[model samples]
Target: MKNLQPIISVESDAKMSKCRTLIMLISPTLVLAIIPIFLSFIIKKLILMTFLIFFGFSSLAMSASDIYFFIVILLKMRNNELFYQEDNKIYILKK
Candidate 1:
């Protein structure tokens, strides 16, 4: 009897490079998500802390929206789909 399971090594340098790229791309979003918690830990003033928390969350929301737009555009480009706009909405055609 012979072992038939295939093994793939992700420890190769090329695979590590891809892993690093993924971490780099995702770290900003992860850090932004944690900013509110970090602010709470550092700020002791109730009023200023509230403002910082508000702005931090607002910025996170804006960043998330931008990420969504970027993903949509990337998908459209990769799928060879045409994007159109109507009433502030985006429409993509199936290719």
Candidate 2:
């Protein structure tokens, strides 16, 4: 059987690479922030810990939003691959 992978264009591949690069850039800071967050919890600093947890979660949410977009693009590519071609047009099975 033939492979059913999406035919990714270079432009979109580059954009995904850019998104991955941004994630790589942010990950280190997020990792570093974890130590302080943990320390605040251990020291029983409720106010500081609460604030840090919120801040950390907000940054994580930003990364998650980026990932969500990336996943949507990947799903679109997969859907494109799943279609059949006819008369130079494309379609999928139904029924």
Judged by TM-score, which candidate is best?
1
**Which portions of model 2 show Cα errors greater than 4 Å?**
1-37, 66-95
10 residues in a row with least lDDT, candidate 1:
9-18
The 10-residue segment of model 2 with minimum total lDDT is 8-17
Candidate 2, residues 2-87, lDDT tens digits: the string is: 54443431122222233344454455445745555666677667788888777766656545644564455445544323333444
Quick one: how many clashes does candidate 1 have?
Answer: 0
Candidate 2 accuracy as lDDT:
0.49
Mind giving the per-residue lDDT tens digits that candidate 1 earns over 46-92? Answer: 98788777766765765674456556454444344444444434455
The total of clashing pairs for model 2 equals 0
Q: Backbone collision count in every prediction?
A: 0, 0
Question: Would you give me the overall lDDT of model 1?
Answer: 0.53
- Listed in order, each prediction's TM-score against the native is 0.38, 0.35
